[model samples]
Target: MLPEAEKLQFLKKTELFSELPETELKSICQIANEVAYPADTTLFEEGDEGDSLYLMVDGEVSIIKAGTEVLFFNEKGYCLGEIALIDNKPRSATVKTVKSTQFLRITRHDFYNAMAREPRIGSGMFRVLNDKIRRDLEIQMSAIRKEVAQEESMRLAAEVQQSLLPNQEISHPYVSSAGYCQPANSVGGDYYDYLSLPDNSIAIFLGDVMGHGYHSAMVAAMTKSCLQTQIPFDASVPEVMKAITRVIEGSRTFIYMTCCYLIIHPDNRFEFANAGHPQMLLYRGNNSEPLELESTFMPVGFARFCESEQYYSTEVEWHSGDLLVLYSDGITEACNPDAEMYGLERFKALISEKRHLSPMKIKTEILSDLRVYQQDESTTDDITLVVAKFL
Candidate 1:
C-alpha cells in the first residue's frame, strides 16, 4: 500500500484531480479505495453500466472491443474508466488486466456526492473532455482535407486524360469516324484514336488497360504516345502493334492492355492486328450478319513473352457504306440489377440495325441504348466505342 502522502501525489498527477484544491484532494484521497488484481483478470466488459473510475497506479491493462485488442496502457497516473464519474453510459470497450495491477478506484456515487461538496474536481473533468474533443476534431478535419486534395488530383488527371483523346468525331472524304468513352471513375483505362494515313487511309487504334484509375490511365497515355511516334513514319498494322507492345513491356506499372489497330485504304481493303482484344465487328452494306474481327494475337503487355512473329496482321474487305465497330469488353459485359449482362449478340444486332446511319449517329444510338440497358450496373468499367463508315 502507498503511504497517504504518496497516494496524494499520484492522484494529483491524474487529469481528473490535477486542478483540485488541497482540501478537496485530501477529501478524495479519504474516499478513494485501493484495489489490486492479478494478470488475465477482466475488470469490466463492453456495455456494462459505467459505475466506477479507476486511477492507474502500476502495471498495465488492455482495452478490447469485439474480441480485438484496441489499446493498452502502462504509464502511471493514466486514468481508466474516468468517464463513469460523469455519465452513466455503458462502457464502450472491455478492460482486462495484462499483469498484476493496482488502481485507486472511485465509485460514481461517491464521486458525485463528493463533487456536490467540492465542485473543482467536476469542472476539471469537463476541461479534460473539452481538450480531448478539440484534439479529436482537429485530427478528423486534417484527414478530410487530405481526402479532398486527393479527389481534386484525380479530377485533374481525368481532364488530362480527356484532352489526350482526339475530337469525338473525325471527318475524312474516304472514311468518316466517331468515338465515345465513359470512364467508370474520374479517370479510366479505355482509349481510342483515329488519324489519316497515306493514300487516303485512316489508321484506327483502340486499347483498354487492365484496370481503371490514374495508374491505368498513365499506361494508356504511354501506349498512345508509343502509337503516335510509330504511326507518323510507318502506320502499318504490324509496325503499330509492335510499338504498342514495346510500351506495355517497358511500363514500370507492369500492366497489360487489350488493343486493336487497323488501317483502312481507298481500295476498300482493311488490315487489322488484334492484341488479345475483344472481337471487332464489321457490318457489310449488304445487311447480312456482321463479320467478327477476331483476336489475332495475345494482349500487349503479355505479348512480350511470345515471339515477334505472333504480333502480326490479317486482311479483311470493306465496301462503300460498310460500318465498322471497335469497342472494349465493357460494352458486352455491362450488367443490370438482375445480374444480367448486355451481351455480345445484342451488341452485334444493334450494329447491324444501325449500319446505314452515319457513324456519328450510330455511335450516339449505341451509347444511348447501353445507358438504358445498364439499369443499375452502368459504370462498373470503362466503356469505349469507335464507329467508322467507309464512304
Candidate 2:
C-alpha cells in the first residue's frame, strides 16, 4: 500500500486523472483497490465485458489479438480498459501481465462516482480514447492501400505478359502443330511459340524461367526476344543456345531458363536440341515407349560456353504417323490433393493411350486427365504443352 501523497502523485502522472486537483485525486484513490498479479497472468480476454479500468503502478502488460501483438502498456502512468469503460462495450483485445504487477483498479461503480464528482477525469479519458481510435484507424487504412496497390500491379503485369506471346498459328503441309500455355497465376515463366521460317521450315520452341511470378515473366519475355532474332531456319542448335546464354548471363538479375527447340523441314528431316528442359517424347505408331530427346547441354545462364565448346543436336527422320510432344515440368510436377506428383511414368502412359488421336485431342485429354488427378489442389507452376504430328 502506497502513502496517500504517493498515490496522489501517481494519479497526477496518469492522463485520465492528471488534470484533477490533489484533493480530488486523493478522494478517487480511496475507492480504487490495489491489486497484485503474478507474472504471466491474464488480466482479461478479448471481447470480455470490461467493467474496470486499471492504472499501472508498476509492471508491464501487452495487448494481443489472435496471437498477434496490437499494443503494449507499461510505466506508472499507463492506463488500460478506459475505452471499454467510456464506450460501455466489451474489451477489444486480450491484456496479459508481462511481469509481477501492481495496479490501482477502479470498478465501473467507483469510476462513475469519480467522473460525476470530478469532471476533469472524465474529460481527460475521452480525449485519450479518441487519440487511440484515430491511430488504429490510420494503421488499418495504410495496410488496405498497400494491398490494393499490389493487386493492381499484378493485373497490369499479367496483361503485359499475355501480349508478349506470339498469336500466330503454324500451318505446314507435312505436319499439323498446336501449342498451349496456361499460367498458374496471372503471370508465369512458361512460354511457347510456333515460328514459320523464311525457308519454309517450321521452328517450335518452349522454355520455362527458373521460378514463377513477375521476375520470371520478365525473363521469359527477354528469352523470347533473344531467340526470335538470333535463330534462323539453318541456325545450329548450339549457336542459338549460345546467343540465348549471352543474354541471360548479361542480365543484372540472377536468372536461368530451360528450353527445347526443334526445326522441321519439308523434306521430312527434323533437328532437336534441349537445354536442361524436360524431355520431348516421340511416339512411334508401333512402339509402346516414346523416344526421349535427352538434354545434352546445361541450362541457359548456368555457365558461359566458349565458342570452341561443342553443342549436340539429334537428327531424326520424321516418319509419317509419328507424333511429337514438347512439354514443361509443370505437367509432371503437378501436385494432387494428397501432395502426390503427377510423375513422368503417368505422363508417358497417357501419351501411349492417346497417341492414335489427333494432336489437339491428345493435348486436351492430357489436360483433362491432369485436372482429374489434381482434384481440388491448385497447380504451383505454369503448364505448357505443344504437339506436332506428321501426316
lDDT of each: 0.83, 0.83
lDDT of 1 by residue, 141-226 (tens): 65566567878999899998998799647677778888888899999999998777767787888999999888999998897788
Using all chains and alpha carbons, the TM-scores for the candidates as numbered come to 0.70, 0.68
- Model 2 lDDT per residue over 1-391, tens place: 9888888888888778888888898898898788989988999988999899898999998777655555566767677787788788888878899899999999988888888898888778877777778756754565466567878998999988887766755656788877788888889999987777777888888899888898899888888888778875346666777777888888887788889888898898899789899899998877889999878777877775434335667888888899999999999999998999999999999989988888889989999999999997988999999988987
Residue 36, model 1: Cα distance from true site in angstroms: 24
Per TM-score, the best of the predicted structures is: 1
Provide C-alpha RMSD values for all models, in order: 8.3, 8.6
- Where does candidate 1 have its weakest 10-residue lDDT segment? 135-144
Counting clashing residue pairs in each candidate, in order, gives: 0, 0
Q: What is the lDDT of residue 149 in candidate 2?
A: 81
